[model samples]
Target: MAILITGGAGYLGSHTAVRLLEKENDVIVMDNFTRSSAEQINRITAAAGRAPEVEDGDVKTKEDLERVFQKYNVEAVIHFAGLKAAGESVEKPLLYYRENLQMTLCLLEIMEDYQVKKLIFSSSAAVYGNCESMPVSESTPKNPINPYGHSKAMIEQMLEDIAQADPAWQITALRYFNPVGAHPSIAVGENPAGTPANLMPILLEAAAGERDAVDVYGTDYDTKDGTGIRDYIHVMDLADGHIAAAASQKHGFHVYNLGTGRGTTVLELINMVERVSGKHIAWEAKARRPGDPAENWADASRAERELGWKASCTLEEMCLHAWKWKEEMHKNTQKGE
Candidate 1:
């Protein structure tokens, strides 16, 4: 039975695919290349010394998923396929609900039919919307403020309910904080299409002159630098966490928060990126984005205790590697143009 990674060419999925390949695990990648790119798959091939068997498919289609399962003896699934733009989800709530929720439901149904029970659910910390408390644990009350986050919450709830109904299913939900940085080799990273809403990518764009300036979401926030604070974990660490969760042979739906247990304000992150890229980041203070929290970090102790996984990369490392990818992608875009 091989491991199947949905959205395998995406930012986080691409990194995870390379790691799983490096570990000599059989991996099958299913991606539609909607939110991801073909270049990332090429980088994964370069990193792994071979390409994972690709299924040009989407999880929203059950037959597309079934075809992959039939082609490969899929025993476990790492689900990462979904629309993830929080702000956009707010604008188009129906699209978010239909795409995110339907995809998970369809995937779960097919997985059940195929008896492929093990699953590593891709979740987000956004589910803990506007967290008034610092350092949230897995047990934190979920109050997602955006449609995108609500979709993830719905999937988590679905996973819980499914696990409860069946003792045979082994599932673990990994709630991620802000995942930044590229792989150590800088081969594959967050190379999102168009302007990225995520913090690091926007900062990289401004520093690389892809954008005129980075917009600081809010300056009146109750943070050390008057900007929103977030726990940024390296993408490599997040990929490793997925591996640990997949390997844990535990039953029932267990959830873990993956983070470094530290927070870096938006301004501080910009400064670090500037330090790494040696490019001054121009900025404009903007109004607070609705549904954004002032601060959010993770108590990753549960992940450490259960999956024996903890993030080890520093903020400096995140900035350095992110800069590396940004520089490389910028050059590639120029070459293509």
Candidate 2:
């Protein structure tokens, strides 16, 4: 039985694929390569010690996904394919809605056709929408302010409805905080095209000398450092959480927050990256972006109690691993030409 990973060439998807393959699971990757590079597929193959069955197609297309399901004995799916830029989602709301929602719907139909009952969905903390309290729980209200977040929330609702209508489906919606760090092997890491919208990638580029300076989105938030606070969880830890969720015997729909349960401000993150990478990060404080939360962490007790999962990596460790991967990426680029 193989695990099908949508967008397996993307950052989080690739990392999760490595973890899955490490556990001796047969893997099949489906990606359109619209924003990802073929280099990522090769890197995943190198880390996994075997070339994964790669299918070049979009999840939004039924015939394409059906072909993948038929070719590989896919027993489960980890859905990671979607548009994820918060700022860009706001600019192109329809594009986000169409791509994210339609893809999930088509995939669900194919899953039904193939009788694939297990799913691990990639969700976000943005669904909380500027939470009024810190350490948000699953009971917190979902009031997403952006299309990207709204799409996740909608899919979660759809999953719940499907579970209610059927008893055999096992769905786990893992709401993630900010995922930073790279694999310790440094074989693969985030390779964003053009400008990055996430904080860690931008900081990593600045540390690697690919960019001049990083822009601190806001510095007047109500936090320890008066900057927007976020829960930074290591990507490996998040991947572990996914594996645990999939292996659990619990049936029906479940939602768990995968986070460190600790908040790190923008300034704190920059200082940590600078210290770890041994680079001077020249940063400029900029105005707050729309829909930016002042503080958002997670009460991951549910995940800890249920999945026996908790993030063990420190912020410094994450920065160190990310810096190592960035250096490796730089070296690889130099050797390529």
In model 1, how large is the Cα lDDT of residue 330? 88
lDDT per model, in order? Answer: 0.91, 0.90
Candidate 1 lDDT by residue in tens digits, 1-337: 6899999999889999999999999889899999877777889998778788888998999889888878889989999988999989989999999998999999999999999899999999988887768889888899999899999999999999999999899999899999999998887888777768788998998998988988888899877879998999999999999999999999999999999999999989999999999999999999998767788999999999988999999999999999998898889889994
User: Relative to the unseen true structure, what is the C-alpha lDDT of residue 191 in candidate 1, on a scale of 0 to 100?
Assistant: 79
lDDT of 2 at 195: 82
Candidate 2: residue 199 Cα off by (Å): 0.8
Tell me the TM-score of each prediction against the true structure. Answer: 0.97, 0.97
Clashes of 2: 0
Winning model by lDDT: 1
Give a tens-digit lDDT track for model 2, residues 1-337.
9999999999899999999998999888899999898889888978777777789999999999989988988889999999898889988999999999999999999999989989999999888888888789999999999899999999999999998898899999999998999888888788888888888988988998989988888888768888988899998998899889879877899999999999888899999999998899999989988768888999999999999999999999899998898888887788993
